[model samples]
Target chain A: MRKFLGLVGAVALLAACETAPTDGANANASGDAAAQKLGPAAGSAQDFVVNVGDRVFFGFDQYNISADARSTLEKQAMWLKKFPGVTIVLEGHADERGTREYNLALGERRANAAKEYLVSLGVDAMRIKTISYGKERPVALGHNEAAWTQNRRAVTVVTVGAGS
Target chain B: MKFCVRFLTLAVLLFSSQAWAELRVDITQGRVEPMPLAVVEFTGDNSDAAQIGAQIAQVVSADLERSGLFRPIDPKAFIQKELSMTTLPRFGDWRILNAQALVQGHAVPQANGELAIQFRLWDVNAETQMVGLAYNTVADNWRRVAHIIADTIYQRITGESGYFDTRIVYVAESGPANKRVKRLAIMDQDGAKHRFLTDGLDLVLTPRFSPTLQEITYLSYYKNTPRVYLFNIDSGRQSILGDFPGMTFAPRFSFDGTKVVMSMARDGNSDIYTMDLATRQTRRVTRHSSIDTSPSYSPDGKSIAFNSDRGGSQQIYVMDSTGKNVRRISFGKGRYATPVWSPRGDLIAFTKMTGGKFYIGVMRTDGSGERLLADGYLVESPTWAPNGRVLMFYRETLRGEKKTTKLYSVDLTGYNEREVITPLEGSDPAWSPLIP
Candidate 1:
């Protein structure tokens, strides 16, 4: 029973670390106060995504939705249900590992995978648009796996909603 | 036009009579040591023509030297001075200076304000003239005249087509890596007369010269949407290509210049498509769900080579012009992309990524005899010179916290790899055909 408890605690810690920023730097270094002003508001598109996470990452050269990605989309679906008039744009990206054109296509596949998952969870297919930036726009500048994992992500940007 | 006719006549006569000892250069051995040659100062009739004569000789010397095939000896080493075009050169004198070949020329101003340039190539060992030719062109075209002269000499010795009279179109990048401003730039093959065609307000990539060498096709981020665009370099006019339902990029002109083959993304699938520039008819080339892009038409215009992920990883594949008989051509260990068919129709240049390194390589059309020419942290987009003997690509290096990109070229023998000087960070170079 003690070993079982320790195992559960380790699993819980791993889960928490997965939710943290992949890069060592804090994405929100200003803390909750500045985040509140610039952050999403309640009953808003920004609020729905930010409060429930707006993006999901993939392994190198892999685009299939992982278990963590599914959970993030589940929260996104629940939040999306709160705002019916909101239209979202799924912007897919890739790490700088492949050619430009191939990466662009890979990004598109990732974005569509997320869009299909959202549609499966009762979101309107017409409300989501997909765009792939390929390896062009990388948020993480490092050339290692840590930065790559963060760069290979599909971001759910609320294009038309309360914030707009 | 008369000048052109006269030039052709002189070339024909000179080539037909060349049975003398030939100065053959074995390029397959690579640039272990450049062949040494001597170019005497060309004489001119007037002070103005004299200045042009000196400049022409200088340009010719630079062209041959840059090829890594010929090394022009210093004029200070010449024992013979100002040999007349009609007289034979003192071959023993040139041989004494360790020059295997000698070039003598003279420029004369014509009555119509055009310039007449005459030159002869001599084999120092055999003490005989290998070939002789003359050119008549407008005074303003002295540079091109020099290039043509250099081409003739290059062909006579190397027995390969020359790329001296060519141009290159590339992307000029500036600013920081986070916010790079790119412009479409063009210049002579020797990096002369460099100029930007675009305002840098829109991001441009992959500028390829059309078959006619009068226009260029490239991708642009216009209005925040990536799309293919065509620019009339001669007229300085730019226009967006045909509209599609979604984003379109990676455009290349057909070998015949009648159509453009590119990639279009729709419904989460990116596929290859070609449009007839004459009729404005769009046709789907590949219907596979895989990402098919970077299509390059073969030199014969009968087949197309492109990069696709349908094989589970990015590799090169070839198909007929109508998208039939598709077959995978790259079976190497790493991923291959940007398979550009060489102008010689003998090899395909591509970018390969493996073992965390990027390589610029070439392989036979059937995917055999793969040879890598350059490797770097990030190198891609291989473009071929008109002669198909040299390749130009960009290399990106990561330094601590900064990344710097520059243009580089390498010959087929994997030697003579050198950086091509650009005013700013350069990428995606397209070599133009030999200018008429």
Candidate 2:
């Protein structure tokens, strides 16, 4: 009878531990889950989705892929390989400090750089189309360093077949 | 004798009343809207004459309406008694339709088989002959006659020269990013008759016309080296203006077409420099560490207005042709660039940036009465039409993920904003003087 009572007490202790009153920890876990939901799907087999804040730095006015950009692109390529049906549009952008025509050319180079990197990583070149918005479209409207960093980027937007 | 005296007294009283009692309405502002005008079909002596007359009239109507300052009212709405241009206009009929102005013309095939078009403008409110113009051109030159008629009407009403006979030279862009193909493009001011001057082998920008309207000077990135080049518009022949080693940009011809002023960069700094076209001699106009570009000569060619960042930020400055008497002109609450001195020499126009907003503004030479004429997400490169009464600039609008840039123009009065139609995206418009 004492052993049976001790077993019941042990089970009760396990239940207490499982449903402990760690409210802050539970809230944090839920918050992380929400963020995961909001973020682009990872480990997808189809196409890779680049978030807006993802940085794609360039060497001056160049659009050539740097080593740092390659690693990020490799991760993107892995996701794209998983999703065979997904397609992406690589959008190139430029900072506001240059002439309009030159910046347009620079933006195109940046987008093409990202696209070429993705292709080199085994993603289908045909799956990626590139366009340059030049300095006309700025993600950040400020004229400071933060805005320039944001503006000088290329975003990979994922799309399904025939639709967005 | 007593009856005559009484009649004279009455006539004197009537004349006095008419002189003093004329309706004095102060037109401080008219509808910034285009003046609605009616152009009836021109009557001709023969069927072919009538056809040519109608074509000329249509051209005139199109020219006026395209200017954005005049809205050629639809002739379909006309209740005029006669559609034929040969008939005298019934003033009462035009007045009933509320047309502020009426244009009527006649085309006749001369004995030499050429066309002679005569037109007249009637101020409906004034009920008098505003002006009469005549044009003689070959059968193929009917369009020219039409344009001339439009110019007459425009000049009579606006008290300014018409830009109908002008052309714009701009850089045409195509191809994907990184490998852009640029060509020199010229088109009518209304954005028609587009022709690419270059074969897209080099990159070109900031094309300007000489006062004679025959020569163009612009910067070309040929063989990866940027230099100023001059091209004869009529012959399509081009040559490098000066043998400069570094980058040369923002080029403009002098008023007499005898010199070229541009910004040349060596090392990392840029300064304004001028080259005598005949002698190929170069002279530095400004010796500053800051960026000094977009140099424009005054109408008299004695002074220049340009933008420089020597004052910690970009502002406009004026200096003599010899690079003396340098003074700051713009003191507004913004960074100003691209200062273009008007052909009229009354005001200096510029592109201003403040609080992340771009503006096209104009100020007197003394930098007073500064007025922000237009605001946009991005508006740059303000070029004056030949008349100095209108300004053409480019605007860009941002969509969700796409951005589009187009050309637009506005009158100096802060009225008449209109889009110039182009087949592709266009910017950096430079208006040429009227072709002599």
Candidate 3:
């Protein structure tokens, strides 16, 4: 196990030097923006999904919310509380490590975990819609852990309200 | 054996012929060395018969070759040319070429504008004929005739049913990695007679054919909502299995072709369900907080094998048809998923992931005797052949920023792994039963 981890670390170091810096910059910017936008009024649900960070990561084969995921969901709940008219869709996803059917169900569990947490923070339950994409739609294309960690996540997507 | 006696009587009364009975190949166990068989080109009674005869012989020989149990010797190595199906071949000549068995055939034009195909299997060393059969079919149905003939030869040699006449349904994928366009595709088991059942307009996955071979059940993203759909391949008609409140996927028909079992996700939880195709009535088979998907019915329709994470990680479990007395069957070091019950009702094939590698393996229904047949960076979704002697799955290989997925087949013995050629990338292949 240690050897496999070391191999992954070595590959990460080699890949770090070869790939473009754009991805790192984008990821860092998103984390920074979410931290900055946690408390203030986000103006719209779309802004909440983007600036306050719409997605939260999970551990391997786990649907339980991690501490880091909890912090991100707190910010999302605050953003949701500010926009009364805004409704959101929680899109669940998983890494490609699991089977398609199981991943779909796991994605659902992850999305609902986030949704339940937001509801506990006073967000309306009916305003949130959930869908599990399983491992089909992935933001990262690589096969390494760096890509898998990003893939196993649930993103809060803002949907247009019927009245709006 | 009957044909041999009949032939001997005729030879004694009408013509002078010599015959011998010998056991050429001892197939008590799996073939460690493929039996060498010489498939002589079938002679044509007429010019029209001759053209079709050659084509039939080519198909039959190709079928035997792909089986990996019989090696069809090259015709150029034959010491004798122009074999007549009525007369026995020279055993000394075949033995010199190291052929254990010989196949001789003839095609003749029949009455009513039909073609009659006759073939005889010879045991070279024993100098005795093993099988003699004749079939009359329309000229256009020559390919099927050839397949039937191959099936007979394979059964007589190996004492196992043949899967050569079967077909496979799969998801044909193309385009860039980010945006793959997938359609449901079908082809002969030999990768011939390829056809697309659906356009690339909507994504389709995990197609399974019914026992009748006329209908297919699969998951399609119709109207952007993934749901189970039944499609009639012959009529080009389709119908939704049911109006589920949420998504339904991973559909497979029961062995009896009466029920369609699938996974339906609702309220962030997925469970196994079955819908009777005849009445459209649905029943939930598994009720659990964790995800339980990929339900496959045992051949006897008495139990179902599926994968669940209820025990905190993905593992295979088997439950009765009523969803009672559920028992965990997989206790491996890593996770197991997609537990497909073998048609023979003895083993289950699954995808195992451990140490950052994916493997296709089979285990006894009780979760013992696990054997990893194939492994790669990303390999899953194994479908068994009609005869349950082989398995087909797709493998994905990473090539820098992109990956390529292709279909591959391996024997149950974990040997003879070969690619199932496709024009485009493929995944989620489902093998159909032998064509009736």
Candidate 1 residues A21-132, lDDT tens each? 4533645656656545654466565465446677887878888898778987898898888888888889889998788778888888899999999999999999998888
User: What ranking of all candidate models by DockQ puts the best one first?
Assistant: 3, 1, 2
Q: Could you give candidate 1's per-residue lDDT for residues B246-318 as a string of tens digits? A: 8788899887889999999987788999999999899999999888999999989899999998989899999
Interface RMSD of 3: 1.5
How does residue B355 of candidate 2 score in lDDT? 85
Ranking by lDDT: 1, 3, 2
The docking category that best describes candidate 2 is incorrect
Winner by DockQ between candidate 2 and candidate 1: 1
| Candidate ordering by TM-score (highest first) | 1, 3, 2
Error of 1 at A76 (Å): 3.2
Q: Give, for candidate 3 chain B, the lowest lDDT window spanning 10 residues.
A: B1-10
Q: List the residue pairs that clash in candidate 2.
A: A45-A82, A45-A83, A46-A82, A46-A83, A108-B177, B43-B85
Please state the error at residue B267 of candidate 1 in Å.
1.7
The best candidate in terms of TM-score = 1
Alpha-carbon local distance difference test for all models: 0.84, 0.71, 0.82
Clash count for each candidate, listed in order shown: 0, 6, 1
Q: Tens-digit lDDT track for model 3 on B354-410?
A: 998999999999999999999988899999988888899999887786788999998
